[model samples]
Target chain A: MNMSRIVRSTANILFPFILVFGFYIIVHGHLTPGGGFQGGAVAATGFVLLLVAFSPDIIRDKFSFNSMKYTEALGLLLFIITAFVAIALGTTFFFNWLANGGIIFGESVAFGANPGILNSAGTIPLMNVAVGIEVIGAMGLIIMYMLSGIEGGNKE
Target chain B: MKSKEILTAIIIAVLAASLLLPSALMVFGSPQNDGMDSYMIDNGQDIAAVNNIVTGVVFDFRGFDTLGEALVLFTAVLGVTLMFRRMKEDEEYEYE
Candidate 1:
């Protein structure tokens, strides 16, 4: 269906909740079954909903091409750097030193959690976060570019 | 929506099973080694350092495929840019 004003208004009201719930799934992924890709797809859904419901220009100012470019590049760099750090530690690539070492980070870490628990997936958690950021950023940027009506090779 | 009927049916069936399998396992299977988890714990470290068995399996043990996926995404973006360049230009000029 074409973008409806009623749908746009409803989405505007619901977008924040969708975004928060998506973040929850991604962050708690290690403890449960969900992870970066699933959560990233969920998060991207919020944006997609906005784009589909409202005209692209309405959300254009909030999500710009430059911002998406920066976030996507940063996400890729972060993933690569994480892998390289494993190499630096003298382990095979993406060897996941953090899990072997037993570290709990980011929000929602349960106190006194032990290694080998479903909740303690080590570097995988961080990797998930990085992937989530990268996926959302890349997709959001691409969508923005398409919706913004920018021509190929145009400086603007 | 009509075109999506078959895909939607498949998706619903899969999701229903994913939801049901875990609960069924909880009733009949042990907490550990529900087939996949044991295999993961066993080979996860040796196959890759990542403690998360699934990650190791997807990103390291099976890394060749992920590389292909990234390349595919890049190519899709390039193709879209080529196809829509003229349309984008027309929209911009109309706005001005």
Candidate 2:
């Protein structure tokens, strides 16, 4: 069942802002206090808000269970693949190979404090994105599954 | 019943003492070993090229731990999915 019109409208308005904030946290994780897991949780909370405001059938139609499952796997796969790429480049596992490589995300940082750079931080940002995606998927799935269980219980 | 109450009180006292003793003895906001902490603070920015030293340490210097943590989350999601799937199947079976 759906919530009151006021609640539904509020959730609708706030959802996009929440998602944008979450993405900002994920992308700027290298420069900010929040990172992948925290940002993903924030984003998943937005989805939870929607689940609470709307009917389960509406959420199920919009966000497929299979897609969420695939997203979780893909995120983990991307993370591991990035690590393995380090090995392929003749470095130890999880090495910061791209830190000073002068390539993508490879601008060398000066020794001490300065304004944070978004294009720097090398594989750290990449890993952060990967983990963020994984976390968003995993957290969304857990809540969705529990909601399903609750619906099933209601039916019986 | 009195003996049981005494035993519970003793257990709670011991647990509280164990938790409080460490905080009472150690200095707040100062680590026992600053060697690694100092090194990371000094060089983590240059090495990882990130302003956030905590992110550098988590994703670069000690990335394996992060990977393990991700694995743990994936496993938990998997377990939840499996449990719920079984419950659904059981419900269907019952209907039949």
Clashing pairs in 2: none
For residues A9-80, write the lDDT of model 2, one tens digit per residue.
999999999999999999999999989999999988898898888888778778878888999999999999
lDDT (Cα, 0-100) at A26 in candidate 2:
94
Best by lDDT: 2
Instruction: Tell me the TM-score of each prediction against the true structure.
Output: 0.64, 0.86
Q: Write the per-residue lDDT of candidate 2 for residues B41-92, one digit (tens) a residue.
A: 9999888898999899999989999999999999999899877774445465
Question: Retained native contacts per candidate, as fractions?
Answer: 0.08, 0.88
For candidate 1, the lDDT comes to 0.63
Choose the strongest candidate by DockQ: 2
Instruction: List TM-scores of chain B, every candidate.
Output: 0.46, 0.66
Candidate 1, A4-59: lDDT as tens digits = 77887888898888888778777766555566667777888888788777655556
Interface RMSD of each: 6.0, 2.5
Give the residue spans of candidate 1 off by over 4 A. A105-119, A149-156, B1-39, B43-56, B59-71, B86-96
